[model samples]
Target chain A: MAHLASFSFTSSPSNSASSLSPLLQSHQQPHLSSPLQDTLINIDNSATMTNSYKYSVLLPTYNERENLPVIVWLLTKTFQENNINYEIIVIDDNSPDGTLVVAEQLQKIYGEDRILLRPRAGKLGLGTAYVHGIQHATGDFIFIMDADMSHHPKFMPEMIRLQQAKNLDVVTGTRYAGNGGVYGWDLRRKVISRGANFLASVLLRPGVSDLTGSFRLYRKEVLSRLIESCISKGYVFQMEMMVRARQFNFTIGEVPITFVDRVFGDSKMGAMEIVSYAQGLWKLFVAV
Target chain B: MTRATEAATAIGILGTIYLALLFQWLPITLPPTIQEFILPVLPWWVLVTFGAYSLGNIGYHVMTFRDCPEAYDELQVQISQAQNDLRSKGIGL
Candidate 1:
């Protein structure tokens, strides 16, 4: 009963159910109940013991020299404070702005074990960057986020907590759900984003909000399988990943996150990107 | 089933029902007033209502979308703190 009291709110209902069963059994066999409750408490302890699980953060970069160090710093700070085991795998696509140079400096500061640099030649796309990053990831779980400061590291612990509580295969950060919002977006940006989200929700019914949000956590095996199944580019890549996860019956959970847009760099939302997004959405609608 | 196929199947079922009613092919009949006045425009009514709902839903979300001024401020402080810490650690940023 005391062990059940310590369970987080997200998992409390289930914990309470298990805790109550022993109490109900106590009414039948008073002597046998103590050992039954002890085993239940031990199960809870073993769940927490699974914190030995390590996270591999795949931060794919292009021209984020100014943002890389700051994002890395925040990630390291968040993980360290939470006593989480994590490694930041920086996959740079040969940004002309010398992002790799800064990543190298960060590795020196954080050590090789913390920061793994996997530099690719030329401006290859994001999907390939993640694939390249995952090939070398050693952790039990994987985190994918933008190098831009828009996807903050602060909400990561909530995502991890939710994943652990629900035993979710994928935990996505949502900017449109409870306590979630965007910082730098104006009315136009808000309108466009909201409209796009509404359309996708109606059409796909993917059961996950914030389809375009890139900040997400996945079991390493689930992510590799998702990557193999996904078939989209640009903004729809993340959306398609959720759609495919549902198609494959992968459990998903959401944590609301504050999106700050880009603090140090220009955010990309051009007509071409929007056109590609529409095309990709339609492709998923028809093909998937 | 893919969403497209699901939607198409639903529409096909509904459309067939409507057509059966419209052509008087069904054993049972819709009321004369409904068959004449309402049935033909039901699809339009649904379309318009759905369009309005979509617009309203998006509008409500846009109006209510949170602006995290505090988060922005906190991020600024963290960024500068990170910069200072990195600088102190001898990593030129």
Candidate 2:
């Protein structure tokens, strides 16, 4: 009878549900746990194991053909050291300088699953590239950073750990925060960056200290929600995302990261970009 | 209308008429002193009317510029079709 009881408890749910025989129910039926109970317990265990989430790193590139290989190496090293399950999704905008070729080589080296190359025709702007990349990302969490090596991969592990520790919806890297600094920036560049951030904060009052920094990790669903709510494009896109995040009451965490100037290729900043940044700020101030 | 509003509207109308006459070959010009002083202290109605007129002119020109290239291509197509039809009907331009 003890053996039968053990067998009944270990059996599947269908078996136990059917085994509630009329004969067993007739005489002062002792509380007999069935195979259904064991099956339910196993299902719960499997569900918990399946819920262990991984991270997807989205690197949007234009023409950083020279910087691609080195940045991928750094990312691989960082994720490997942290023992985190992560995938790097490269969203390239069809760089004429053979950036896709280098990306293909990286994919071969790191297996197709780990390195995903999502390329678009022409330079279709930064905001859309991120949206396109996010559509294909399979991870529960998404990390966005520059592919130009300006945003270091070293800071990513800390951002991930902090997000995990606090259960934060978003973790952004700030250059203006404690122990964080920008290297290879002249006086004019620093002033422009600082002034832009100040102006945006004054107008929008986004709780984040660095509204323009693109290096951050977001819960995949949270990012999808935020991206849909945002309207601005190009450099202003980052600022608007933070503003929308605050409006939606999403929890945000910040980590200090040293932003280095890209060693390869020319800086994409220009006079028109600054003008558009100002215009974007004004639009957000009035619209939001 | 209140006296102030009447006076302001009158000034606006007079100024616009004066500008139209000047553009249409009227041999009249405001004295430097009047131009410097009176124009600076123009009433709100006068200033707003002038601004509206300027904005209307700008909007017209902007629309024209925006549509000119496409409009020209469309006109060319129409003219070519007309010429072909005329030739088919044994006529010439």
Among these predicted structures, which one has the highest lDDT?
Answer: 1
lDDT of 2 by residue, B1-93 (tens): 322354468679988875555454455677776666655555565778867865554454333221123333433454455445434543322
Q: Which regions of candidate 1 fall more than 4 Å away from where they truly are? A: A1-50
- Candidate 2 docks with a DockQ of 0.01
Cα RMSD to native, each candidate?
Answer: 6.7, 25.9
What lDDT tens digits, residue by residue, belong to model 2 across residues A60-124?
88777767776776788777765778899999989988888878877877889999999998899
Clash pairs for candidate 1: none
Residue A272, candidate 1: C-alpha displacement in angstroms: 1.7
Top DockQ model = 1
Residue B47 in model 1: shift from native, Å? 1.1
**Candidate 1 chain A: worst 10 consecutive residues by lDDT?**
A16-25
Q: Model 2 chain A — which ten-residue stretch has the worst lDDT?
A: A18-27
How well does candidate 1 score on lDDT at residue A288? 79
Model 2 TM-score (B-chain only): 0.34
